[model samples]
Target: MTAEKANNLLEQIARSKKEGRLPPVHDWHPPFCGDIDMVIKADGSWHYMGSPIGRERMVRLFSTVLRRDDDDYFLVTPVEKVGITVEDVPFVVTAVQVRDVEGAQVLEFTTSVGDTVVASAENPMRVELDPQTQEPRPYILIRDRLEARIHRNVFYELVEMAKPTLIDGVEWFGVESAGEFFRIAPVS
Candidate 1:
């Protein structure tokens, strides 16, 4: 990315962060400024011009303005929008916090970019098996079509908390969070 372009993007994100809220990029209809040499890799690392973004604060700031439209990702502000590449998803679930509220289990996920979201109907978790490896790839919805891939250790924690239950005549292993049962795998 060019210095001028990076500076413009950083300036806008800094302003939005200072307001303590994200700007409504979904509501804004700005002209696309074409693609930039930026990519959010599958492991949640931010790269610009083929180099990893070393600053945590800088990555966090850029994440706030990220938006997904259809299959494309963009860094959007009110006045400008620039497309970027994402390998898998934009975020990664770094940690999981399990809590009990009135005997109901609640799973809270902390994203790499520092956003926390409770697993519920609004923010649901799903697991998809990898086609080649057949291993489960779990993800949790964050916000506005963005999802976080659950870390391996966190997924192990979830598996430990899972219970066997029957769903629609099929035995399943899953966990309940926020009164919703999310099936992790079907018992054989």
Candidate 2:
């Protein structure tokens, strides 16, 4: 895509965000305008045309227009939709905060794109262990089928706060947030 058109897309997304709290990309049904040389790396870095998108603000702006349909990721506006490559998940959880809400310990996660989400029944957390290495791939839901992979440091913090809970007659290590219990790992 041309730089001018890209700027136009950014302007459109910015205007939509100003009008409401988020871009209306979900409500848009724009036709696919083919692929763009953009990539969201697993490390939560954005690249375009094989160059890193250094500006944090610009990356956040593009994230607002990002949408997922089924398994594919796209950048959408009222008039256009274009595909982009995602290495793993779109966002990465960079920080996590703990607070008590009505006597329940709440976990609030901050993503690379500046989205803050509280882990609850609506936005649960999960962990997937790698088969070969047994590495933990933890994630928390952000919004609209989008999730952020919990960063290593943040995951460690979560583990430090984990407690055992009974599930299916077995003890599992998990955390509590927003009155919801989320299993991090099954005790072996």
Top candidate, metric lDDT = 2
Model 2 misplacement above 4 A: none
Tell me the tens digit of each residue's lDDT in model 1 across 86-131: 9999999999998999998899999999999999999999999999
Candidate 1 ranges beyond 4 A from true positions: none
Give TM per candidate: 0.97, 0.97
RMSD of 1: 0.9
- Model 1 alpha-carbon miss at residue 75, Å: 0.3
Q: How many residue pairs clash in each candidate at the backbone level?
A: 0, 0
